[model samples]
Target: MSNANSDPLIVSHDLESISDVMRIVNREIWVVTAAAGNERGGLVATWVSAASIDDQTPTVLVGLAPNHYTTQLVEQSGSLTLHLLRESQLDVAWNFALGSGHDRDKLATLEYLLGATDAPRLRDCLAWLDCRVFARLVTGERHLYWVDVVAAARVHPGDALREHQLFASATPEQRQQLIANRDADITLQRPAAITWRKCLPEHLYFQPTQPTN
Candidate 1:
């Protein structure tokens, strides 16, 4: 039998090891929607987490790739709605993930209403959070937003869709497309990550100390 280390697909064995360790973490899929004036966009995202635990103040941290159209909308509007999809909402996930909002309107067919933050909230989600971006960090390939939860609701009673289930349920053609998209994104983002620069607001910026002999 051929050794696992000799696999042709293993671009970097070190990175592959990191990926293996990260797979143990639970990543729930979410649909993040944003609207800027007449423009609106949505995309499937997995990089969301609760940033604050204070009962009086709730916040969430979301990371979006800089290249996505939805990321542009979030930057323009400074607000977005994150939706937790039920297992039955795989179609919603496919719609947002498979197509680019730059090419066409992804929210055209989805039933939604404007939330308190002016972000488009999908009606069919298991739950939703309407958030306003209070702080942003530019991490080269990704834009990390710290958002205050302005409003939220639990709409339906169902198990939230997970990343593994979505992949298992995907058609063979869709699986191929998903893999292609993943590879394309990695190729596009790798360069940006390598040459990352710090860009922060005046209040958030600080000069790095120089090493001296």
Candidate 2:
């Protein structure tokens, strides 16, 4: 017997249900910034998290897709800077995620400074952490790096952006445009895995239903 959830049609219809659950997961939005010599690149990401609790050894994990220019720079430089975005800094998030560093300099248009790790520290962020690559593992389609947090600073000390908030606030059209732009960037990376579909699968969506007789 085929599992109903595994059926393509059922899965398609359950997209909104999946999104409803995911939006409340409270993943903080971040910009993973890096520099390779003169080449500077950054990308909007939510896949960063602390990997260790050792006070003497601050560690973080940043998952970067192999196909992005930022990922290449991080590999070559062996370092990265993670920036926490403010809720108001949506433009900063879009700039890094939608634009291609291969065609133009992404950091040139933004205000930033060279950190101790030689990574680009985005000035518009609420806080930043400079990390040194301790080790790397090829995890699925992403290069998951175990980094030691060498330095950190609170730039603004204000409310940080959350992935769920971004989706909840954007209209359908705005969401669609953002997803389209992101897809274009992912195409450049040509990874075996694709990003999760951020848009609702169809115009009509259903809320979670309780048992009704």
Candidate 3:
């Protein structure tokens, strides 16, 4: 008889076993854009999924960290735009992922057009979906927004980038910085609404700690 423990994918029986498994999981990388009044921002996101199977009422869910300026914008405007990237758009992915919008406009240097919901639809991408938030649930340190698919279109025809691909291809320095940044972000419990971090590319990968002199 075959046993589950003999499965090649199975790790140890410890509760924390899946932490390493998640790193290799195939997830689609996406750019999430949003606007609130005059404020607009976007970020690279991997936690997105179809929330409904109904043909008449299509729905989707995106998880955004509350500390992000883009998350605040979506919370205020109740809308977001999810953009799919091509394999050739690695620069675009890093451009959005490695910055904050609090100090400057992250989209200022990019080409995009305002969609029906006033969210920016990136010009250089495989596809985009404009969504309107219907409800939000607090999940861990992130907020999962349930939204209706208001508009969608494929702007380009190409293979989309995947989360596993990025992690696998990242340079050693980049991977180490990402790990450090992620750990710093986890330790920070920023208030629900506040601009505590500056907008800069380096801020996305490394969070410097000041020494008490």
Q: Model 1, 161: alpha-carbon shift in Å?
A: 0.5
Query: Per-residue lDDT for 133 in model 1?
Result: 96
Model 1 CA lDDT for position 33: 96
lDDT of 3 by residue, 1-213 (tens): 444564333346653767776755888889999998888998889989998989799999899987889999998899999999998777788777675888778888899999989899888899999999998866446788999999999988878998877777678887887788687676664432122232223534476789898
Off by over 4 Å in 2: 1-19, 168-174, 181-213
The lDDT leader among the candidates is: 1
> Backbone collision count in every prediction?
0, 1, 0
Residue pairs with backbone overlap in model 3: none
- What TM-scores do the predictions have? 0.85, 0.75, 0.78
Q: Model 1 shows how many backbone clashes?
A: 0
- Residues 1-213 of candidate 1: C-alpha lDDT, one tens digit per residue: 434754333446578688888887768999999999999999999999999889699999999999999999999999999999998998899999897899999999989999999999998899999999999987666899999999999998879999988888899999999999888888898666655533344665578989999
Over 4 Å off, model 3? 1-16, 189-213
Least well predicted 10-residue stretch by lDDT in candidate 1: 1-10
The Cα error of candidate 3 at residue 127, in Å, is 0.4
| lDDT comparison, 1 vs 2, better candidate | 1
lDDT of each: 0.89, 0.80, 0.81
Worst 10 residues of 3 by lDDT: 191-200
Q: Which ten residues in a row have the lowest lDDT in candidate 2?
A: 191-200
